[model samples]
Target: MEAKENTTPTPTTTTTNQPELFTASDVARFCQVDLKTIHNWADKGEIRHFRTPGRHLRFRRLDVLDFLRKYGYPIPEVLRLGKPKVVAVDDDPVVLASLRKALSKRFELTTFQDPFDALVAVGSIQPDAMIFDVRMPGLDGVKCLERLRSIDTTSHIRCIVYSDAEEMKKNATEAGAYDFIKKGEAAELRDSLERLMGLERE
Candidate 1:
């Protein structure tokens, strides 16, 4: 009866976690480009990168995904971090449409035509960033920004005030906005967002 005892063993499974930061050679391999090209990109500020204490270059996973998406490169499965969640609140439907067209590909965008509604949903949305219009009918962007800053739950969300009135920049900054981008400056907005993602530029 003792010889009839079974000797089955349980199989163990292992999982590998992807890195949050990558080396130049790692990025090169991911992009299918030579190491020199990666260096060039870093030098030219075409990709988001930082230098280690030893002067070695390092890139964040999100930044690599941004580079791949911006340049039409195929994103490797290992490097596919989800897009940054963004909430754009603007009273103007047209402006919201333009934002959708411009940033939809790079960000997981949610738009609100009413500032109060945006505020109500912000806690639940937990967006990485918010795009606010300086002037709106119900709650102006600056006030919205102030409200969010006062709330502990939404205070840490990066807020960007998108407006054509250059005069509002000061107020926006005072209201705790991370940056103010003049409307129609798509490139500047993209650059600001890249910086928000912790990209270091020389």
Candidate 2:
């Protein structure tokens, strides 16, 4: 049996503020599949896409990212648009929703309701920063931060503690939290994260 030929393109340096579009051929090249497979994906509504005025199939960058993430594909750097990735661990659904509303536009945000799950995923996510709710059911935020600090792969990730309890600040700091923010302070959290990630406000 012959090994499948790998045709993944080299990462490009193109950066754009506007939404980027990829043709079916580009998607095929990125996925290392036949061009017809991409068209079939579009036709089957497996991949979110639109048609140009000339009826040429086009896939938005975000849509492509979603598809790649869903299917466990290695995300190409060009599709990342240099956005700082962030992972947030919170038990409250409302808090997660609020965090998503506040931070999704500025960063590549991924949230987990379970701190344990976040801990497991963080190694693979390799986010630039993480937000942890101080009070969770199974694994509290401080322990989570401490665990990450103990691990070589995750120790370098900047972590911020989010909670209403101010008393946890010292403990969180000692546990290696990069910063601490009170819950409901979305603006402050965003600013702190931007600074931590070295991203200028747009």
Per-residue accuracy of model 2 over 26-63 as CA lDDT, tens digit each: 78887999999998999999997888779899876656
The local lDDT score (0 to 100) that residue 57 gets in candidate 2 is: 96
Candidate 1 C-alpha lDDT tens digits along 52-141: 889999876656777887888876766544456677877777777777777766666777776777777777766668887788776666
Mark the 10 consecutive residues where model 2 has the least summed lDDT.
1-10
- Alpha-carbon runs more than 4 Å astray in model 1: 1-80, 199-202
TM-score of 1: 0.58
Q: What overall lDDT goes with each candidate model?
A: 0.72, 0.74
Top candidate when judged by TM-score against the true structure? 2
In Å, residue 54's CA in model 1 sits off its true spot by: 38
Residue 48 of model 2 has an lDDT of: 78
Misplaced by over 4 Å in model 2 are 1-81
How accurate locally is residue 196 in candidate 2, as Cα lDDT from 0 to 100? Answer: 60
